[model samples]
Target chain A: MALADARALVPHLPAFPHDPAGDGAMLMRAVEACERYTPMVAPDGEDALVLDLTGCFEGQGWTRETIARDALAHLARMGLGGRAAHGPTPDAALALARFGMDELADLPVAALALGAEADLALRRAGLRTIGALAARPRAPLAARFGRELPVRLARLLGEEDRRITPHRPAGAIRAERRFAEPLASVAPLLDVIEGLAQRLESVLARRGEGGRRFDVALFRTDGHVARLAVACGRPLRDPPAIRRLFSERLESLSDPLDPGFGYDMARMAVPLAERLENEQRDLACGEGGEAQPDLAPLLDRLAVRFGPDRIRRFHPRDEHLPEYAARPVPPESGPAAWPRPEPGEPPLRPLFLYDPPRPVGVVAEVPDGPPRRFVWRGKHHRVVRHEGPERIAYPWWKHPEGRGPTRDYYRVEDEMGQRFWLFRHGLYASESDHPQWYLHGLFA
Target chain B: MTDSPILRLGSRALSAPVPKGRGVIGLDVPEVDRWLKGGLRRDGLHEFYAPSGSPPGPAMALALLAGMRNCGQGRSLMWLRARGGRRKDGPHAPGLAELGIDPAALLLLELADPADLLVAGVESLRHGGAGAVVLELRGRCRALDLTASRRLALAAERSGTMALIVRGDARPVPSAAHTRWQVSAAPSRALPANAPGHPVFDLQLLRQRGGAEGLHVQLEWNREQAVFRTPIYGDPPAVPAGRAEDRRARRAA
Candidate 1:
């Protein structure tokens, strides 16, 4: 019924505007809460969550009914009202729960999720209930109504099965702990994390594998999930080192972890793992000059405290443009193999390079020749000896509009012996009337 | 011979030899090494400052070369600096490669502030895996005080990694450094085409812990041989214009 008619009949009914985005956010939170039961939880529509409880039943040693009942109670504690059901496929269960009915046969044809016109056409054809549609021959029903109708009908009847893509990929190795009472202190949190790490270590050692990345999910009592993730330089399985990394990560957080209303459970999972072989350690210090201490632990500690991006290794790229020739890569990619320079060539590149190249006032002997004198940063320099203009043409094929102007670069040394790399932006006569000069880099 | 009776000391004590901690990595320039008492100390803290209103490239390059000498082979070279020191385009990798520094063993850390940079520097120095650690600081850093320098010195001594601090336009302060030097760029020899040759550095030893200080030397870097040579002087300046005109005439013919 329209709100106007309802308001006229029963006066003073509070009305608010419809908000689809707000409703979707609330549904996503419900999906996150349902993940405590199984990692394979997906939000069905704007109202319901679908969880594939396949092995969870056997793992927890609980019947399907008890699990569904416990899920509903858990949602209720989080101030959400919902209905739960069990079926062979996720689609059947979602339809049963959304309609708030136990029997699938009594569900209306709207559960097929066809457009409004198709729904009206199906009802007008005297098929108002799914039971009537399922009883008829699927060939004629698809021929008359639509091809999608039979597929939907089959799913509702639990005749076809398709898995739901979960919100998070289920980890191969994981451990979880639940507190009897709400744990409010930070001391016991580390202990709980340590216990979980120990459990995960034994499983990883048995398989001769170690984890490269570990994720910790802390479920607070007030329906909030706080997550922490850390990656190591090398594959690691020792529990104490893992605990220390977590402690360092916690100590460096800007907004410290707050156990609002305490935490209900903590779950630790290894998302990425690699193979690690056990090796015998040397009895004495390593022989010769190769006895270097392990640097991975120190790098890992600093990376956790200060972000990994801050610690980097140089990676060179093969490009003609100076700016795109090199980049700083994060340390986890390991050291990059840089191409060696020619043995006899003098240092052609500069140690420090400026971006957008600092513009300078230049006075050259000829317009198309090398620079004679230039002023930069309020200091004037006379170029005694200079090299030819090494022409580096910009990649014209990369652009769609037209070809970019050619650049004339020169390696000029000032009277002070400080060398500079300068380039003319464009050809003087062909590209523009007046070309600009820029200081690109400085050589030691 | 005819000495006072009260002055009874051994001749070995009279020599007064300076204690060289760990060892020294020579630069191979006979003149500078003689003043350095065998090149720079391997397990010591050394500071480098740029000249007045000049760029820090010369100072930075000098530190890296000395650090590489201490590193030798198979060990890593780490550069630690505070944020805002680099432009959009970072340090050129090819230039370092031309200088014979292996890119695979180079590690860089740009911290949030000066304090964090020092902390990370100390941490890196504590590890023996680091063959050389270069700490680059710009401007006047109040965080790097005497105590922090002392801490870095102690850690470097314990781990046997050479530490080089490059201060750009920053005044020299009292610290536990074993030697301090001021580095500036000097002219290079003209190559065949009258272009600039290799890099040349003019270094002034401002202070040494237990040795003579006011020594000045000019050294030119030879990339092929991976060594420094005293620049050869006493020749007229080459006229680059004449060389260029001659090449043009030959091409036209």
Candidate 2:
């Protein structure tokens, strides 16, 4: 049979059950594996992959025909049947795969085309062989079949006149499943999310890539779409990390995802990916050298429960006053380093520092030293050993609310071993009749 | 003949065999190690009490990591269980690396759930060929019973690893292990001519297996080298008997 006759049988092929697209994924994987042999490869529709082995063939000391035979053998091992032809262009190889006059000529014309349109074209032309099609004038055939036919024909003849463009694979993989039943509660949805995340992770692992952002789509029974997306500060493959990120976004979902009938389906996709290398650190010595505690996960959970905007870290501002020294910032948007206190500063710093220092009343204040006695939390306590009057002045440009005040912080040890970090808010200037004292944090 | 009897008594006292080989170095004060049979046992859980208002938690944890880095070949993994609570408020990664630990070898597992933290701890202990496991919890871990501790101990023993538990203040004692220490900030020392100031800590040996008990050691942390060293103490002034009495009373009060 001639090549054109075989090429014409493509449209009329009957669909095979359980062979949708004739194992496209398997074929792609096999082709990708072959890329180590040569970088240039193109898919011939659904069933075949074409490799440009011109430069590679010489290095292997094999003729083009011999290399084609080895490629077919490798495909056979992968349970795929294919025919290869060495042509100058990708389009030519594809055409040759369809209708080359090789030993594969015994395969039916319908098998080569793989569908019905080719069969109809062959019948209309009354062409039985590729030789017959080659006999026709190029101009008429181009007019009758449009531009693709002659271009494809020229490629098959090893003419380098036409260029073949290969399709690029998707940068990231995505899969979606529409449920027959809508999910109403959090439990079932969590199960689906877990499964989806696992599948996405496996795909990424195979590609040697990790995802930093993922999007989950919830298609409701009422035809509404609810999409959630989460981003990680770093690329991660650990399922727990992915789950935690998703949980945060899920909690903040605004339009109550009511499963009217239920969510029809959930689709998970990796929109962005990055290559990540594993990290390693040296171990500490002694019992103290054991693992240190990580607070990120807890912060993530808290940010999910409370809105992300509500949670913040106290960053010590580069200022003198205790109240002006610290600012609240979103958990995600800050440097990892916590600001250090200056030398000769007050000894005591509170572990749990409040945003705005709460006010208290002080009975006696000595210049250049801590308060002698103070009323805090509705009680009186005498300072035994007091340090400081570490004076902190405000930034003149960015005045705090209800400011016009400078603070003198003191590290006062109570009768007990317990210590208190207190500061007088206003200066001793007579212009301000009332000076306020505030309690900031407690020292361990 | 009387001298011979005295020599025999002296030999017996020396032969009682002081326990001092097990406590973790660079962590327990010399006196605390004397009580702990050495330092913290090489393969057991050492719990720390971190009250909300305590500075000792971060200080002790940093000291522990520094010690482990000194002893072990590779990086250490720290499993933090609470958010915002386990801030590496002091001694960030770079600071730790300068202290002879490879920062690249440190693996920080910041997990949200306590169950996940436990699982990671077990898995890391089992597979992570690192030297130690540190768990920072909000309160006492009632969940970590004797059985769990034994399992963790067995894992550590098999891997020749160590586990440190830093529990928040108010947590009741969970399970007994090799050593337990409580830490508190001592007092700050004056800065030198132009150097950054050092943080001073009074590490009290609350519990130990064999060494001295109720011992206090003062340490000054050098920020630049990321190392800790004993500070020089001034000479003790001679006091009048009445003044001495007053000093004792004030201390007791």
Candidate 3:
């Protein structure tokens, strides 16, 4: 019915426009808020949510009924009216919420959320309640009303199994701290983190494992949650090291943390872990003999401060293209053997090279003579000596574009005592009449 | 004086001092090594600067680094550049490898802030694993003041790691650097005519603490021998008049 007609029938009737988008955004916010109770919270359609509280409240001194009541109360405080039910399966809990179980066999058929046509058909057939529907022959009922009715009925009556997918991954090991008064400063929060780290260290140590990823969830009193996550370079169980990593991370964030009202609770969790074993320390000659540089801690501190992408190790690639000759990879992941120059040889190449070689005006003898003098960056230099015509052909197979031609490189020294690596783009006779020259590199 | 043996021994000890090997790195060249108070000091900051628009400062710094890397076999080196000063086309590994530097032994860090360059330099020196730390900053940086240089020098002294700072096109300022060199590119030798020869540098020692300054040397890097050699004919090479005569005689024959 239209709102105008409904309002005309009842003089004082309240109505509002349907807003599905706004409702969906509010539903997501509610799901995030419900994570405090359990990480395994899923949005069940638009009006309901499913939480697997199987092991969530273990040792928390709360039973299923109390937890459900608290959850409803929490939602009520947020200006939302909610009803909850506990059952062995999600379908049973959903059915129980809309129907009373005092007379278990007599619940109305409308609670099944089936189509209106199906409800009316069942009513016309004298199947008024669940018990009445159960008394009828299964095949005729299913054939008339479709097969979904019996399946949903079976799931609701605990005859079929059901499952829910959590919105976020559940933590394998978690430790939470609740405060009587909210924490407003960084020091106390860091103290709490240190305590939690120590606790997690012991737990990980018992299983001969260490945490690879640690996440801290901060719950503010104003209903805002801030999450901080730090990843370890290796499986780490040291509390001090973990604390230092967090300190560096917190200090390096561009957007500083602001405790608007204060954080009421904070929880730390290990989402990923790996096996680790302690190494035997060398007691004899321990002072100076052991010179192994422990680079992991330093790398971890740097990676936490400046993102992992910013800190990388270079690897020599087996390619002739100047740019493709080297690649940057994550530290500790590159190949062990890196290419090196022959011992005690003067450097054959320039110390610095400009990628996509910069253009420079060249004055050379006719044909293929080296540049007598070159003008680079608006500066004229008289070349006292020059070397080269080191011809490097383009790898035509790799680059099908074939736009690039063979280049002849020369190392030229100017009067100012500077050496430059210059190249001609193409041969004068074979490639082009006007072969352009470029400054490719500098020899220090 | 000859009456007491104790007095005579005291006088002999006072006259002859012990040959100390502190703060000196040998260049293996007799003339330049003797001129540098033994060699480049390992305990203090050495500044390499070139005029504005010139690119020889980095070259000189790299040459020195190549020399040091060869001397300290197991030690690593850290190279830092200001993030803003770095071009997408700055230094490539293949090029550095050609300069006789092991890419694995060099840790290159492009810091975000110019101030962080100095900090990283000091830290790298203090880390002790690196044989030397090279910091390249373009133009002038306000954060790299006297105090920062002093801190770097102190760190270098304590850790015995050589500290080299390369500056571009900036006037010399008051710094804690123990030695300052003004390097510029010089004309190379004409061995094979029209072909570039080994790198030639006109390095001027502008300032040296507790030592004479205003010393200039023409040094040539011998790629085959891996050492710096003083040019035999100094410079200009007598205009190479004899080479032209030889070419004319061969044509006549």
Full-model lDDT for every candidate: 0.82, 0.54, 0.71
Residue-wise lDDT of candidate 2 within A23-115, one digit each (tens)? 787766666545434546666667777776656655455677666775666566556677776556565556656765452223233432425
lDDT of 1 by residue, A1-444 (tens): 999999999898999999999888877777777777788999876777889888887656668888788678777877888888888788889888888788888999998888899999999999998998989999999998889999988888989888799988889999987777878866777788888999999999998999898899888776667888888888998888899888878888898889878888889999999998887787665566457877787788889989887888888887788877777887767777887766555677887778768899999988988999999988999998777687888877677678777889888899988888899989989996788999988888
lDDT per residue (tens digit) for residues A1-444 in model 3 = 988899889979987789999898777767766777788889888888888787877777768888788677667756677888877778777767657463435677876679899889888978888777767777887899989889877776677878788888888787888788988876677778888899998888888998888898887665567888888778888988888888877887788888877887888899999898887766774676435344566556666776665555567888765656778676657334565554433344777767768998888877577888788888898877566666777888787886577889887777665778888988898898889999888777
A118 Cα displacement, candidate 1 (Å): 11
Candidate 1 vs 2: which has more DockQ = 1
Angstrom error of the Cα, residue A168, model 1: value is: 2.5
TM-score per candidate, in order?
0.81, 0.47, 0.83
Best by lDDT: 1
State the lDDT at A81 in candidate 2: 74
Q: Score the docking of each candidate (DockQ).
A: 0.43, 0.05, 0.30
A311, model 2: CA deviation in Å? 9.2
Global fold similarity of model 2 (TM-score):
0.47
lDDT of 1 at A353: 75
- Candidate 2 error regions (>4 Å): A1-173, A178-210, A218-230, A236-265, A271-354, A358-369, A374-384, A400-402, A414-419, B1-25, B41-44, B50-178, B182-253
Superposition error at A177 for model 3 (Å): 3.5
TM-score of model 3's chain A, to 2 decimals?
0.87
Supply every candidate's count of residue pairs whose N, Cα or C atoms clash at under 3 angstroms: 0, 69, 11
In model 1, pairs of residues that clash are none
